[model samples]
Target: MHIESDQEGYRSCVNNSTSCQAYITYQALQDDTLQPVGLCFRLSVEQLAEALQIAQYLSVALDLFTSMDCELSSVTYIVGLKACRGLASEKESDKGLYLEKGITIHKGVKEHGFKTDIVVATNFLEMYSNCSSMHHAREVFESMFSQDAVAWNTLILGYVENGDYAVAMDLFSIMDCEPNCVTYLAALKACGGLASEPESEKQHHLQKGIGIHKKLQEGGFGSDIVVAITLVDMYGECGSMQNARDVFDRMIQCNAVTWTSLILGYVGNGQCSEAMDLFARMDCE
Candidate 1:
């Protein structure tokens, strides 16, 4: 919780307290009521875990849920798991505590027979991933009756985080569907984690990365500048300066990352003058 006093009349708010119950819960969570600490949490299910008023938030959610008369589905579980993320971020001890809470809620949803729902499975995978339990995430993912790109990406991300780049790449290889920008980004990051190969062997991954880039273009998913930047980094890291330059030149707009990667690539190749020039240009921009 935090507070601020400005030139205008003092105004305060709790971060995730968009609703009245949220505000009440925020106030109630802390022992001190007269002096409310201004705190803001992310306004999502994962973030809601930190609310001072868990019961209130749940009550509000339950009321609206009942009023709508919509069946509780996997979507609800996913949302709540997402809120767990916020709670996890609060502290290291809190991270495990919140994750356990999220798991319990997810288990309750499953006990009610929504276990087959993909969204719920995805959320479970996500929660487990955040909890640093890739094995649990994989278990949930494998049990999923329905899976989609997001599910794949979540698992891929978990593998990447676990430093199992080879397994991440294998997952990518076995994916029977086309990779999206997010998928490609995760794979590219995994490539960075891979063991250092000889220049010749590194060239193979470079070719594959370029192939993926072309596929992205052909699929018309060109708006992801992160993908473009990662390509430059991948090629540069692999000692392929020419390919790095090609990608750098093709970008229509250059952010700090693009400029830095290009500069670093030039520096890595002993092109000090070119790197300096690029750095100067970035400063001007």
Candidate 2:
């Protein structure tokens, strides 16, 4: 009875607090004050886990999952892994701690025999990707995969992030599904990365980047503001000011990234006056 009282008191304190309400309790999930938009939510553990993770109450969600007496499902594990990423990114000092915790959660999933489940494996891949744990991400990729683009894109993005640009492009080339915007972006980034290699690679990188640009247009993604901006960056990285300008000219809408990349391309090519002119236009626009 004493322990029950303390638990209730703790729940009450957390429920009333504005910023530090990080505790998890079944009763708390039912409280009127905490119901989202005033709707009663008698959420199951799985649903509450997802809800709490979406709300950025990451620690609270983990607590709820860990405290549950029933058998945990794959959805809960997926949400828990994502929450681990949230905590890892919430602070620079605490990143390593949460990454370690993510690995531990992966261990539990393996013990529960969900390791063979492709959807669970994909979320684990995403968690490892977010933490830039490429080694673990690769392991998850090899353990289970499908012909869908989502898993392939996540792994490709992971390689691009870790600066394994060659591997990134290779993965993109071998992907079974038609490349999507994310896949193209990662591949384009890989092409841009090659410009920093030996001078012998510059022409090759530029040509490959052009191919990607053509593909983007063919896929009707070239006009997208972000993709166009990345195209400008890829051109600048490959030392192709003309191609950069071509992309800029074709842009239906431009943002600071588009303008900045164009200006930087000029500056990189020793055309400081051209850069200044573009900067002036940017400032006005």
Clashes of each: 9, 0
**How high is the lDDT of residue 155 in model 1?**
94
Worst 10-residue stretch by lDDT in candidate 2? Answer: 34-43
Residue-level lDDT tens digits of model 1 in 185-278: 8887777556245556676776677777787777776556787788788777766788788888888888888989889978976889989998
Q: For candidate 2, what is the TM-score? A: 0.81
Prediction RMSDs, each to the true structure: 8.8, 5.9
- Candidate 1 residue 166 C-alpha distance from true site, Å: 1.1
Q: Which candidate is the best by TM-score?
A: 2
Q: lDDT at 207 for candidate 1?
A: 69
Task: Give residue 231's error in model 1 in angstroms.
Answer: 1.3
Clashing pairs in 1: 2-38, 15-39, 15-40, 16-41, 45-83, 46-82, 46-83, 46-84, 47-83
Model 1 CA RMSD to the hidden true structure, in angstroms: 8.8
